[model samples]
Target: MTTPPHHPARRNLLRVAAAGAVSAAGLAAATPAWGRTTAAPASPPPGLSDPVQRGDLVVDVRDHGAVGDGVADDTAAIQAALDEGRGRTVYIPPGTYPVSTMLTVFGGTTVLATATTVIRRTDGPSIVGNGVLGDMTATGFDGESDIVIQGGVWDVNASNVALNGNGFSFSHGRNIRVYDVRVRDVQGWHAMELNAVETVRVVNCRFEGFSDPQGNRQYSEAVHMDYAGGPGHFTLFGAPDFYGCKDVEVSGCYAGPSADFPSYPRLVGSHGGPDGHQHTGLRVVSNYADQCTEWAVRLYDWLDGVVQGNQIVGGGGGIQIGPAGVQTGGNVVVSGNTLRGLAGVQEAAGRPPDAAICVGRLNNARTHRLTVADNVVEGVAMEGISVYRTDGCVVSGNVVEDCEGAGIRLHDAPRAVVTSNAVARTGGESIVVADASNAALVAQNRADDATAAGVRVTGTVAEVVVRGNVVRGDAAYGIAIGAGATGTWHTGNDLRGGYTTGPVDDQGSGSLTDPAGVA
Candidate 1:
């Protein structure tokens, strides 16, 4: 193996050429006509001794003796190109390059391939395709920088390879961008695991075909926004230290079934660190997720996050948010999304069932200032949008229809405002404020054709103001208050065509006001 000359910085060649264009104009203007008609052979073009010439800025994998014939190894040759092509672009042409071992990617390198390029994994043990080679110690975020793996189809070949590993696994990197890539058939582990990094973006990618090889860990994500929280949190083969991810964006991706296998169980989410050591500025937006065994998006513990504008279908559940800092669930926003056909297949033991969007892990009152607004939900197996154990939250401006349970329910949530929403054709109540949800304001909502009451204030609650709602169509009771409720005020509700039984069935003795004559 002959080494090239010790020259670098091919990335600066474009700016250097632009600068030289101005300099050449100035020089030609100053020098009076030393010009022959042939222009003196172009002055040999700059960087005469550089290892990477301008014409060879894109180093092809074939140049390093890689026969991408699908039968040859091509591992050593492609790896040779990668090791020497650091700070440059290694272009893999359209072919199937199978490897029996793992390939390592260095920092400041770009592994670019055509749309027809498929890097398939041969039979191997613990092989992660095109991952980092070194610097994976216990210290977090100390590994690499300026890495880009874009535009290829990375096939894990899960049926042949039983040892569980990811398609692309890297840790402790910053300024990483993975764009326009597709990963298929990852077994047991995630398709892409980016752990403990800062400032990353995964855009316009597709994750297809994931299954658990050992029949365990059936709920792995396609794109896991993980952190270095000790042994299993990272993809490296050892114990990593405690660090978290911050300023991450995973947008415009698709996570679902492949051509042959099922979709990844958890599409895109994070099972984050402890309460105090939390991640920040995470966004899972504008993606399509389906057929997940767990929640499509789970914000376990993060700060200042946004799960917005996603289209989810046929998942176990929709977006779920838990604690981030101390007891606080972080200042998060869940809005402008469409969720349908959720069943909550793998919900935790004491949690509610099949809510399209759930705001808490349980009846947790420490998550404050959360917002769930402007979403659309239909064909849900249970509740449409539910929150529990929160404080000062707002559930507003949503359209929920054809739910098996309540459209919107608040459990053990205090100081919540459920306003300007619409619920229709529910199997149970349209809206429910129960489980000691105190200081709630349920106003200006439109409920229609529920099997149970339009609005029900049950359990042990206090200071729940139900005002100015329009409950239309027929139900068991228009607004039924359970006997265990207290301080429930109802005023200015229009229940003209509602309630097959009666208009307002107020059984609680601690009630304050009633609907204005049910006319």
Candidate 2:
């Protein structure tokens, strides 16, 4: 007999919540559905004990009729473990098990494959969580809490693979870990997709070879999060992809060569919405990126995150703070990173063209309280740090060199502070504040060997403080404050080595003089 249709309202409610579509009122309205539904049986199946302890049942995929050969299908041997009906660790010995289907596990379960245990798929997503329901069917398993997939290779050749999240109609799963694995050659979408998963840790893993067909031009990201495409409203989808997913850490991992689209290959990345609500609470530390067409790290709807000590080289942009049309605020600290070889459109042969970093505003929304400090940026095509339409952001203690454009460009910003930064050998202006206004501060920054002015301030900037900066060997003026600019204070700066002062037309009541100890 068919399983009675699980309560439609309740199922839809769960699906909506997982997808982050439910509103506050909708959530409250659906509460009764949850309360009224009879809970699933808590007891274990026959010959199974409650609170299924580890080491109780040991199943070897090889012994349980798995072929163990690199070319043989191992779906049956793998299913035997899941069918046993208890929490246990299924061990896969050192052999390549080729499978076309997705392998899923129940709650309180661990799938332990040795480093040499290779689960290769001729198709896509060798192992998956059966949380969401869709066509091109794969395995479905529940009990996500305390689930661990460690020490093996999950090769995905498919284009679209959806994992945990409310949008996938999953629930309350926590502490899922994927460690010490290699994921390669995903022919479809995101190699790894983490949806509303909490306390998830992915460490010591390698993700590579993301390729797509010509003209498809799809967006596949290596690791993506957020709630998208479910029955609920957008607000019900909850915080942005990484929001509310607390203490999520991605360390010691490598992601690169994100695929383009059309040939139906994987390797693209895109956010799910335009609502200014999602946020990312990510700690991307000690990771390495190279030759990724997209950004090395794309922070969408992010807030209060830390991106530090990461080595990012050769990409479209090393790190993109926020995409367009999102509200990103609160303590995004980027520090102690090394960025090099950011080639832009016109690079010499054999050199990639990209930017070191691009900090963009989301939908004209003001991003505030950003602290970018102590980073070394070298050989970038564009500005080392480019802030667009942001406020209350600070860039300090950074060393930028050999950039084709301005070392630091602040556009349409207010209440921004740039201090103690060393900008050198730039083909463009060393520091450019274009058309920015109101309470901006540029202090104690050094500009040397700039092809353009050391600092170029244009338009009407009110109450802008330019203090204690050193400008030397600039091709143009040491400080160029355009006509009609007003209310700028320039004090305690040392201008030397062929740098001359430009006309300072003070339109408003702002003083330009030296103050003691301004450095």
Candidate 3:
């Protein structure tokens, strides 16, 4: 692939323009010539700022006996600046610094570079030059404790470049930021991996060229978080392992082209192991995931996190909440997002179809309190939302269109509240409640142009409250309550399509009072 050119002079001019803006009073008082704002002095080139104007201890990586041009090993020269300790800035001049090994940043070190400064690697093992990877497995030194690596291009030739590898790796240090950078071409795992680190923020970054054709190994994820991978025959780490890494925020980033199939990307998650206590208090917001072969965002296990305001398109599933055999629960909310063109029918083309949002088992045999609400789903081949083996969850206020299976599905869950959703043009039932016992509520939703019933409740559903809903243009019955269902109260609902059991009495012992004469 052809690389983009880096212009230092243009960057310098932009920086001057940014710093040149002044208050109206100051501009008028200082300079009135030519109607321009303020008179500013000419600034030096980006990396060539005077020592007095530069940050503390500016050690140029190229001047410290390092070489660029996609060759020559500059690991030692770069490591020297990291060894200088806190409150120092390492300046990388405008050139491509090829790395064959990982480079670790120590506490109080700031790596500030121009856009022309590129840290890259050649094709080799997953481990390659200068950027942080498996070779440097130390803690509290890779962008931790007020360390910042900003304003540069980081091109990864290999995959799995991690700042801290696993749970054994811990950085108590805080306030780390990797901002305004570009990371490209990671072959395995994540482009940027942070394990058990505190207060880490990645903003305004781009990760590209992460693909695996053979599918032998997992391909690329832009940003990854988890507890350290644990030991023994079982490879994955448990949920408690990542509890140390809290308050992690990843915003305004992009990751794509993860696997051979354009629809699936590698899984992104905080929980890695069977223990089901890994990640907690995390936020993955305002990001974009395109051409992913798998899930766009996967939350394995945790509590109190928001996956909001994201654009996820062309993935196997937009979001997979809790995988089977994991207990991820408590105050988790997935809201206000746009997920389109999810490929769910390909997995079940011959068998029964599935849903778009697949909520798997609760963690450690425990129920969770989940809220999946206020999202727009379009062009999904399966159900719009699917719940499996979860309890005390609310799936409400979502709009789904052009789905092949049920719009909202409840399977083997108890006490779930499905309300205020609008589903249209579905090939199957608009809402299906299956095997849910102990009182579930399906209320105030609209199902239109469904081939089957608007609501189908089956398999031991008890004490269900189907109230204040509208069903129209269904080919079959408007509502079908199965034989085993008990104590169901169908109250004040509009059923435009005829019912199979004739006009059953409202379970609340109330009469239909609407002017249309049906409820």
State every prediction's TM-score relative to the real structure. 0.85, 0.76, 0.77
Give the higher-TM-score candidate: 1 or 2: 1
How many angstroms is residue 319 displaced in model 3 relative to the true structure, after the best TM-score fit?
0.5
lDDT of 3 by residue, 1-519 (tens): 111123332243244334336543454466445444233323334554422112223445644566655567777776665666246666666667776545666666666766777777543332212224333333332334666666777765535443311111223345666667776666545566655566777777776666454564442356666554444211221222323356777777776652322322643565454554456677878888786666677766656777887887875667767743554455678888888897763433466445667676334344378889998888886678888777788999999898888888888778999999999988788898888645788889998878777887777767677788998873577777777777676768788665554433323222223434343
For residues 1-519, write the lDDT of model 2, one tens digit per residue.
Answer: 011123322233234225234443454455555332132222222442222112224444544667656777887687676545235566666667776555555565666666666776654333555232233221111225666666777666444433211111222255666667777666534556665555666677777766554423234456655443334311221222322334466777777653532211212222533454454566777777665655667666666677887787775557766644644555688888888886553224764343465666335665667888999999877767877767788889999999988898787778888999999999888887766646678889999988878877777666678888898893667877766466677877787658544423233444556565224
Q: Model 1, clash count?
A: 2
* Regions of model 2 farther than 4 Å from truth: 1-57, 83-86, 124-126, 130-143, 157-172, 215-219, 231-244, 257-277, 323-326, 345-355, 500-511, 514-519
Model 1 clashing residue pairs (backbone): 363-389, 364-389
Cα lDDT tens digits, model 1, 273-340, are 76455778988889999787778888767789988999999968788887743446668899999998
Candidate 2 TM-score versus the reference = 0.76
Q: Give the RMSD in angstroms, all C-alphas superposed, for model 2.
A: 12.8
Ranked by lDDT from best down, the candidates are 1, 3, 2
lDDT (C-alpha, whole model) for all candidates: 0.76, 0.60, 0.62
Provide the clashing-pair count of each candidate structure.
Answer: 2, 40, 23
Better of 1 and 3 by lDDT: 1
Candidate 2 vs candidate 3: the lDDT winner is: 3
Highest TM-score: which candidate? 1
